[model samples]
Target chain A: MISFDLRIDRRGFSFDVSGQFDEGVTAVFGPSGAGKTTLLNCLAGSMRPDSGSIEIDGENVYSSADGIWVRPEKRRIGTVYQDGALFPHLSVRRNIDFGWKLVPAEQRRLDPLEIVELLGLSDLLERMPSELSGGERQRVAIARALAISPRLFLLDEPLASLDVARKGSILNYLKRVHDEFKIPMVYVSHSVTEVVSIASHAMLIRDGSVLGFDRPSALLLTAALDGSSVERFENILHGVVGESTDQLTTIEIDRISISTRHQNKNPGEKVVVSLGANQIILAPSEPNQLSARNVLKGRVKEIWSSNGKVFAEVDVGPEIIVELTESALNELGISVRSDVFLIFKSSSVDVFDA
Target chain B: MSSDASIIVLSFQIALVATGVTLPVGMLIAWLLARKQFHGKFALDVFVSLPLALPPVVVGYALLWLVGTHSWFGSLGESVFGSTLAFTWIAAALAAAVVSLPLVVRSFTAALAGVDPRLEVAARGLGSGSFRTFFTITLPLAYRGVIAGALLGFVRALSEFGATIVVAGNIPGRTQTIPAAIFTRISAGDSDAAWRLTIVSILLGVMALATHNWLLKLSSTVSRDSSEVG
Candidate 1:
């Protein structure tokens, strides 16, 4: 666990934050230039706060009042930067073991071989950083961080620089690492999908201040309500593959079968379906002859209105959220506990392996 | 030793020593200039780059004032070396280093500036001390420029004339480098030796420049490959 109450005063901007991070991945989500990186830097001890204190598991790492600033090397924290920052001169093996060798022999908690296997970096051991692909380099970066058995891990959008395909694979690998290591982490990212996929806890930050911090599922709802730069609300539904055709795949969620674009999966295989909240269309009842392939009935569980826009969560076997204008809601006379048909194109559901 | 061999050998020795002295100092100044912020930083920048704009003879004159028999360093030089630093081989080497230092510092600064400081921060966050991070990350990444800078210094030191003449004087087989020896040959109407020394100096210049370019090409190819992978 890591806790900090810090303030940074600069000529252009000031940052103020107080929070505690627990076990598992805590995604710090916000738009660009949100002082997310500055917060991480202060925690890493690279940037000292103008005033206030930081403690890692109750050990005070920095306190301006006590003049007890610890050097970054002594902080026992690991950081994976957005750019992968592997040592250009060292081989993958040496880079991964760079920090591991520094710790006393008896105190080492993780094995180099184990990390190489976990991150799938066995073949890259002899390769130079310059010779590895972006994904491979990031894997090596994570492996190197894990080698140190750090007290806490800080990841500043490790997948931001990768392409979509690479991002998906890397996200899966990150989840595996987090699950295996169980170290508390502060993962900074601006992507909503990434936060939903990996983070158990979420911190909403904007303009150098902590907006809210809690479970991702709970905090994101409030974030959508606030409408303060947390753009593009997305809903992730867990389901299982049921039937598939060349053009269509049906996913069974509880008692409902929802169709999506063709997915390469077998029956009974677990999958996750992603649909943007803005993509869902709601009607008072099922409309005939619609081009949309999926339509299910559900009673509205909750509805929050702001700025003439209504965000409603509907329970149709698997819960779905739909964002609509207040005018449309008024016209349809929809309210909480009202039965409604949620419709969306099959192509809109992006299915990924769980 | 023959005049030709003596000129060639002593010139190389002086250049080697000058480059050796300039490298570490140049890298230190370059790292500071690239990474730090402090009062008088601009003044320091101007001071470090002054030699590039000033004439070599002016540097020689300043060296003469500092190391001549009239100052504290001069007295130390006298006691340590059994003579004033002026008109000595050591003074020739010192003069060459001063004239070439700006080139070393400039190349090093540019190289250091190109490196991402975030890499160093990441290293520190991974439990690496500042010194370790520098040697492991910063130095290796900037080595191409560092070598290029040293080659430039060596070439400049090898051809030094104005400053060496002012401080080291034209003592054959002692402080008479290639340029000084060329002057000596041409002054005595020995056109053949002058022409031969001229050819040697040209060849040396060409070789040093070629090496510098080759190193740059190698560094670029490696960087390009790394970026492609990235």
Candidate 2:
């Protein structure tokens, strides 16, 4: 495991983050110039932040205050850049086994032959780097880094340069490597697809600060992914697949049961339900159960404002947040501790990024 | 015919000796210029290239003062070899090397600059130090440039006229080179013999260019093949 408090100042931007990179894949996702790659460089000991501490397995690799900055070459952390950075003169075999044979015989963890086979480079071992495809070159780069048997791995947009198909294949390979290695990795990428596929934990960064860090499933339902960025109807909700009924359906988000008129996939398949939070209407005084497909009664737990709009936190057994206009809240006489019916048009929302 | 032919042969021998003597030092200096950045790097670079802009006679005179058995370097040369460098084949070689230093440096510098720094990082992480990476990765990658520079330096030394005449004194068979002998024959009105050596000069120039082009082609072809495989 690796833990670091990042405080990187470059040009006009400054990034500060405090998080734990546990063993497995932890992805840093954000827009461009968000200092994700800069963080990787810090972890690799190549780019020392303005001031912070970096520790791997509780061993401090760098701390500017204590004068404990470790040089990159001495840092025993493997870094794979976007270019792969394979040595051109060395054959694929030599490139992959480059540092493996140099380490004291006892410390070498993975066998060179095994890495070659794992990376599918056995047939191309004798060939030089100039002879490999982009995908093959990246594989060799990964194998070479693994050959060093380092305690930590830093992958900075390893598939960012490849085409879509190649990127997909390489990302899959990367996921497999992260799963098998058990070494802590700080995977830096801006692509949503790449992050969603392999990252168990996500750190949402913007403007050089850690906007949020949480498990992907939890963060998906928050206001961040609530389609605030998208005005259409976007909401991420976590719920389990309940027993199938009829054309009329039953759905459970956390503990509160909601009847969704939309049906996709079979029962027992857990999923993240995404829909327009704006579609939910608040009704406090309804004479009869109207034509609204989803009508769940829950108390208004919290009300928050953003950009002059309102989002009501509803405690439907558990808490579920809904975004709506201030006019609608006032028209329904909605306030904290007020019991209100939640109406949503089912089939307008569907499960995504399961 | 025999005298003219002998002058031509001796002139070529002197050029060959000069090229052979200057090559290794030129290569080392070129690598230093291309790969290192020390204090006064620009000053040192200018110093290495000075022989190119300076008059060939000035370079010859400077060498004469430095190694002509009277000055400090001349005295050191006398102490080391017990023979003065002036009016000697070695002096012509030294003069040609001085003049050709810039070419080798520029060519080799470009070659070294083309090597990707990422490759060096990969090698170092793989546990090889600076020297190993330079030799195994950097040097081989830029070999065409090195070869082209060497050939260019050799050609410059082979065609050296002003410096050779001043330092080596254009003696027949022992210190003479083709260009120096041709100059002497022209001065003495031996037109037919001068023309013959002129043909030899032309041939040498063509061969240097041919070799340079061949090396360039080979470099590109090899690079293409490697990239296709990689």
Candidate 3:
């Protein structure tokens, strides 16, 4: 467990936040300039807080009352930045070895080769950081951080620099690392889809303060209700490849199957699919002769309105959020527990290897 | 060795020793100035840079006052070495180091400053101490600039004249460096010898400066490529 109550006053902005994060992945979610990165820095011991204390696993790393502070090197916490920050002078192999060699033999738990393989960096070992793509650099950064076997992992928008496809790929890698290593992580991001997909617990920050803290879905719902979330929401689903034809591929999710544009994946392979909330069309009854594919009957489990737009949660095998304008919501007369059909084109669904 | 050969060798020795001593010390001061924010920073900066702005003769006079036989530093040297440092080859090297320090510091400061502090932060996060990070990450990345700075300092030390002449008087076989020897030869109407030494000095200066420029070009290209991709 990690906990902190920190207050730092800058020239024009002040950051004051206090929260306790549990063992699983807890995402610090907020908009840009909301002091999320500052909080991460304070926790990593890179930036000192003007007041209060920070404790990790019941050990006091910093305390104003006690006048105790630990240097960043001794903190045993690893941070991955958005830009990768790989040493430009070193090759990927040396970069991964950098932290691994620093840890004493008895203290080393994870092998460097395991981490390298886990991040799929075997081919790029001899290459310099400049030679790798953005996603590849991030993978190397993650491997470098994990080599030390840190007590806590702090990721600051690790995927913010990646494209949509690369983001999904790295997200899967991160999930596997978390599951395999069992190291607690504090993920910082502004994307609701990323937070909801990876984080078990979420803390909402706004204007240098904690807005709410709870499960990611609950906190995001609260954020939406308060009109704080202005970005478009995304629905992420996991499934296995079922059947493939020349035109389309079917992915089985829970009891229902979703067909997407032809994907070059073998049968029985797991894949993740992402669809924007606005991409979904809701109809009161089944419409005949529609060009769109993959229509499923579902019930409106919940409904809410924010920022002059209406959002409804429909339970079709898996819960998917749909966004509609106020006029459309009123025209459909959709209410909670109403039967509806969720219709979307196969081209709208983005599939990635799981 | 011939007198001219001895003078050239002595000049090379003094310049090499001066550059060797100033390299590490200049790097330390340059790093401190580049990466730190502390009290008296401006004063420290100005003091290190004073030699660049003040007349070389004035700097020599100040050194003479500080390390002359009557002064405490001079007496301490006398007690340790059984002699004073004034009017010796070592004094010439000392004068050269002082005159060339600011140029070294300026080059080193720019070099170290060009490195991304985030890389250092990343190193610290990876369990490397601050000192280790400096050696492993910061130093390796800025090595081209460091070498260029050292070469610049060496060239400045090689051409040092006014300060060396005052502190270490011209003694043909012992303390006479190229510049002092050239001055002596010119005064004695040895125009041929003066012209020969002048050509040699210009050749050495051009070589050092060309190498410095080449290394700078390479460093800039590498940095540009990395930044474009990064």
Candidate 4:
């Protein structure tokens, strides 16, 4: 577990945050200027907090009252910045070996080649950072950070620079890293979909203060209702691959199966599917001959209005939030406890490694 | 003819020693000025830059006081070397180094500053301390600029005249560099010797400057390409 209560005052911005994050991926979600990066910097020991205490795995790394401060190198915390920040002069292999070689043999836990293989950077080992693509550079950065066997891994918007397709692939690699290594991570991002897809716990921060901390979906809902601008809502569902064909794959979520466009995943593999709340259409009865592949029977569990839109929480095995206009809600006579069928095309669901 | 060749060799020796002495010290000062904040930073910067603004003769006079057998350093030098340092070839090299240090520091400062500080931070995060990071990452990235800075310092040291004469004197075989030799030859009405040394000095200066400019351009390109990747 990692816990910190930090306060820092800049020229015009002040940050006061305190949270205890458990083992797993805990995301610090916020807007661009919301002090998410500042908080990460404090945790990584790059920036000192004006006053506070930070404890990692029951050891006090920082405590202002005790006058104790661990340097970044001694903290054993690995950090991956948004830009990768690889040494431009070193080859990819040398970059990964940099931190690994610094660790004492008795303390080293990870094999360097394993990290290279994990990030699929074998062929690029001889190439300099400038020779690699943006995605490849980021992968090398991740591999470099992982080579240190850091007790607490901190990433600040690692996917923010990648394109959408690249982001999805990198996110999959990140999930695999977490699952394989079991390193506790504090990931900072502004994307709700990323947090929902990867983070087991989420903290919503705004203007240097944490607005909420809970499960990713719940915090996002509260944040959205609290007037925080979530660009669009996405329903993230975790499931296992039930069956696969060349045309489609069926994902079983809490005993309810939903089909998505063909994925390369094998049967029984765990995956997370993301469908935009706005893409879901609601039908009062099971419609026949619908072109959409997914038609799940559900009942509205709750209804709320925010930012001139209506959000209906429907329990279709897993609770999913569907966005609709106020007029549509009234026209369909949708309310809490009303029976409805959620419809979405299989192509609309984005499947990612869980 | 032999005298002119000896003067050229002596000038190269003095300039090479000066550049060698100033390279490490100048890089240290540049790194400090570029990467650190301290109470006396401004004062230190001013002190380092004093040689650039003060007349070379004035700088030579200050050096004369500091090593003229009357000061603590002079006493130490006397005990260590069995002689006062002001009138020796070492004094000439010292004078050249002092006059050229500011140029080296200016170039090194710009070079070190051009490197991304974030890379250093990343190294530190990866378990390398500040000193290790400087050697492993910062130095390699800024080596081109460092070479350019050293070249610039070498050229400045080669052409050093007023200060070398004041401290080391115009000893033909010991302390007379090319510039001082040119002065001595002109004084003796040996225009041919003076003109020969002048041409050699110009050629050396142009060669060093051209290399410095090329290295600087290459360093800029490297940084630009890396920035695009980053």
Candidate 5:
């Protein structure tokens, strides 16, 4: 776990950060120049914050109130710089050993042979830094950092300097590292897509401040999806596997029964159901030979009118609202304290983890 | 006249000989000034460049007084080698070294400062300490600057005039260098002979400037290329 209430003054730009990351990859995502690297530096003991506390895995690495600040070397936090900062004169093997030698014999944590093989650096160990490819150099850099057996790994856009193809290859390796080791990592990146798959917890920063903090799955389909519409989608889910006849791949979310729209699903395999007010159909009595697969009976609890249309609140045990056009409202005569039936085709339901 | 060629030839001998002798010590001092910040830096900096600012007559007088026949250093030299530095080209070279100290110190310091502090920090984070990092990363990288300092100090040594004349005493083919030789011919009112030696000194200077520029250009080119390729 890593936690800090770090406040660093950066030439008039102050970075005030206070958060905790227990395990897995906690992403520090924000626009460029949003104090991402500065925060990482503070945690690494490279840049001392003007004031505040920095605790890593329950260890107080830096604390201003008690007048404590650990040196970078003593802190044992490994950093992978944006430029990789590998010693240009040393070959791959020597560069990796650079950190291992710093660790005392008893404290030495990593097996060099495994790291070399894992990073595919065995063949390139003898080659000078100038001879390695960009991807190869980054792998060596990662191995070098890993060799130290750091308490916390701070990666400052480790693959930001690479091209698209190179970045893809490196991201795969990063995912493997994150999953296999379960190492506490503070991943700094600007891309939303990059953090989606791996980042279990996220801190969204903007203008040198964190805007929000939550799990990645919840954070994504939230407020920032559309600026102009501001249409709050209640993480709407409704769908089913319409193709397969062997089983009903439909799910019931409230009054809506939903099946897979395009792809077929197994029987009762947890499908999401999107319950939109507009798709609901109301009938006074049982309707037969109707294309709709669902017929739910309910009493009209209340009638609310808005935006040149009428909305009826129907009590279907869990309860839901259905929207009707003004003309349809006149024909149905739906009003408060009136009995009504809700009929809708299961195909009308749109389901996605969206 | 045979006198003129021999006089011109003596200047080359002095410039080469002095520069070769001072090169190593000059580089070491330059490195010192560049890397280490001591309590008495201003004093040390001033002391190194004092020979440049002070008149050569003062330098010669100081050297003469320090190593004169009355001084223990001179007496020791006489007793040991049966020779004195007071009237030799070696004494002239020492005088030249003092005057040329600033050149080496200035160039080396600039290059050392240009090396990134973060690179050194990275080296330490990688486990190399104060001394090893300096010798391995800082020194090799600052090599181009050291060479520049060396060449500048060499050129400065070549042009030694007043101190060389006063200490080494303008002995032809012995202590007399090109500048001293030119002084000799000029004192004889042989303008053509003086001008011939002057021409050789000018060529040596032009060659130093060309070499310095070429070296500077090449160093910059190599650094730029390496960074880009990396």
Candidate 6:
């Protein structure tokens, strides 16, 4: 676990934040100038907090009261910056080894070759940072950070600078790294899509204060999937596989069973499912003989109206948020506390090992 | 050695020694001016550039006051070397270093400032301490500008006459550099020897300036390339 309670006032901005990030990826999401980078820097030992302390895995890294502060190098916190900040003077191999060599032999958790292979950097090892593309540079930067065997990994918008195509590829690499390393990471980004894609938990920040912190699904169901922002449609739901068939698999969340496309997971295996809010359809009653495979009944918990569209949350065992036009909502005449059917195709859900 | 040959060799030696001494000191001052924040920073900046604004003779006098025989440092020099610092080849090199140090510091400061401070921060983030970052990252990135500055200082020292004549005096085959020997030749009414020395001085100055300009060009190109990569 990593926790920090920091207060800082600098350059026309005041930030006060306190939170704990347990094992796994805890994404810090906020709009621009929302103290996201400042928070990350404070934890990384780059920005000094005016008051309070920081601890990683129960060890104090910074304490304003005791005048104790571990330097960035000794903090054992690895960082992957937005610009990929690879040493331009060094080759890819040398850049990765730069941190690897500094780690003492007894504490080294990763082999140099394994990281190179994991990040697909074996072919580019002899190339300089200048010769690589944006995605390639970020890959090398991640490899360099992992080589250090840090106690906590801090990533400050590692994909914010990449184009859409590169962003997709890099996100896949990040997922692979997340699965391989099992190291706790603090990822900061403005994109809800990126956050939902990798982060298991999400912390929402606005105007320098944390507005919300919880599992991404809960956070998204409340404030994000209101169709107010199209980006938040990517909501992650956690579940475990109940039964499997050739065409579909039954994943259970709480008391609900969600049928998704076959995801190569055996029964009783834990999984996380990604369901886009726009893909889900809501009905006033149970729809029979519909093309969609999965349909569950629940009461409308809440409804939000904006820009001629309606976003409703239906608590079908687990809350299923969906978006529809104002005309469709009026035609169905569904309101809060009204029983409704939540419907989506089996193939609409994307499942991954949790 | 011939009189002209001895003057040229002595000038080269004095220039070399001056450059070697100026490099580390100038870089330190440059780094301070470029990266550090302190209370007396503006005062130190003005003090470093003092020699550039003042006449070389005035700078030589200031050095004399600080290191001449009557001063404590001069007595200490006497105790250490069994001779006063003034009127020696060592004094000439010191005068050269003092006169050209401002140029070196200025060039170095400009170069060091051009480097992105974020790169150093990234280095520190990647487990390098401040000291290691200077040698491994900061120094390498800023080396081209530093080399150009050193070359500029070397040429300035090689051509220094006002400060050397005041502090070291004209002692042929011992303290007389190319510029000092030229002064002596002209004062002794040997116009032909003076003309020969003048030609050599112009040639050396042209070569030094060309080399310095070349280094500056190389630094710019390298900086552009590295920035592209970074």
lDDT of each: 0.87, 0.73, 0.89, 0.90, 0.71, 0.85
Q: Indicate the residue-level lDDT of B205 in model 3.
A: 96
Q: Assess candidate 1 and give its lDDT.
A: 0.87
* Chain B TM-score against the true chain B, candidate 1: 0.95
- Of the pair 1 and 2, which is ahead by lDDT? 1
Locate the minimum summed-lDDT window of 10 residues in model 3 chain B.
B1-10
Docking level for model 3: medium
Encode model 3's per-residue lDDT on A179-272: one tens digit a residue.
9998889999998776667788999898898998998767766676667542666677889999999999999999999889998789999877
What order do candidates take by TM-score, descending? 1, 3, 4, 6, 2, 5
Best by lDDT: 4
Model 3 / residue B139 / CA error / Å: 1.1
Off by over 4 Å in 5: A53-61, A65-69, A180-182, A219-354, B1-102, B109-118, B162-185, B188-214
Note the B-chain TM-score for every model: 0.95, 0.88, 0.97, 0.97, 0.83, 0.94
Q: Model 4 — TM-score against the truth?
A: 0.90
Q: After superposition, how far is residue A321 of candidate 2 from its true place, in Å?
A: 7.5
Where's the lowest-lDDT run of ten residues in candidate 1 chain B? B221-230
After superposing candidate 1 on the true structure, give the runs of residues whose Cα lies further than 4 Å from its correct spot: A264-273, A350-354
Q: Comparing 1 and 4 by DockQ, which wins?
A: 1
Question: Residue A107 deviation, candidate 2, in Å?
Answer: 2.5
**C-alpha lDDT (0 to 100) for residue A352 of candidate 5:** 35
Task: Give stretches of model 2 more than 4 Å off.
Answer: A1-22, A29-31, A42-74, A88-91, A123-133, A163-168, A200-354, B1-39, B68-72, B218-230
Enumerate residue pairs that collide in model 6.
Answer: none
Q: Between candidates 3 and 4, which one is better according to DockQ?
A: 3
Error of 1 at A176 (Å): 2.2
- Residue-level lDDT of model 4, residues A76-153, one tens digit each, is 888988989989888999999999999888878889899889889889999999899889988999999999999988
Candidate achieving the largest TM-score: 1
Clashing pairs in 3: none
Q: What residue runs in model 3 are displaced by over 4 Å at the alpha carbon? A: A236-241, A251-257, A261-274, A282-291, A294-302, A314-319, A327-343, A347-354, B69-75, B78-84
